[model samples]
Target: MKNFVFSEAVVMAGLRWTIVLIFMLFGLAKFAEYEAAGVAKIAAHYPLFAWMYPLWGESGASNVIGTIELLTGAMIAVGAFSARASFVGGLMGIFTFCVTLSFALGAPAFWEAGYGAPFLGSTGQFLVKDAVLLAACFAIMVDGLRRHTAP
Candidate 1:
């Protein structure tokens, strides 16, 4: 059990699939009207994403994001066999998570009412988990680079 848990190959595969499934699932969700509207509300609060609403409106913006997520997931899935593919996938994943984490710019308001930090409201909980995913992206990037450059 310990060996399985600690094995580089096993751990790498686990990390790879974890990211793949998350992106895939969330990407698919974006196409739903409820999900798209919810995402729009959150994106509206972030300056960087504000332009998307004007340019694409709600569903269009959501579809754009969903496409990117699906593509990134596909790249990561292909990463299982190709270091270069994995490297690109990791880069995309890093960017994706960074953008999501940027939502933290508005995080204080996301805390449960009458409470503060350490107590998270719904949005706060959703955004904070990206930190772990961001770390995983870094790991994937580093390993991909190492493998790609190995002689």
Candidate 2:
């Protein structure tokens, strides 16, 4: 047991679970009016999601996204059985944040405040932080792929 490197294992496991928790909590929150409304406001400015309102409406779309997030979190928590799940979840996270980050381009109000490139407002800063999570998700995906393909 002395040779086992328990500290590294603990840190890795903690990071994985942290990713899982983030998705799960936000996924669950998507059902709430406040959360769903907030998502709608930003999604409105995202051109990629423009078709969403006409098809399923904001609440419906949010619930669908919530289901995806909840499933992603549950799958991430599955350890070895999570190989494909984590990869897909990571891709999903990357997609979500890419759209979120685009707000810097799509929303002029973000720049009109004189906050400059960094986006000084709470909402602007909130989307900016997703870049860190996006990178972490990529790392999770790479690790999962390595484990899956290892001999």
Q: What lDDT does each candidate get? A: 0.88, 0.73
TM-score of 2: 0.82
What candidate 1 gets wrong by more than 4 Å, as runs, is 1-6
* lDDT (Cα, tens digit) per residue for candidate 1, span 92-124: 999999999888776556688889777888888
Query: Using alpha carbons, what is the TM-score of model 1?
Result: 0.91
State the lDDT of candidate 2 residue by residue for 1-151, as single tens digits: 7787666447657777898899899999988888878888877557777677668888887888789788877767775366676666666666766766877675645643765665466666666777887786777777677767878
User: Best TM-score goes to which candidate?
Assistant: 1
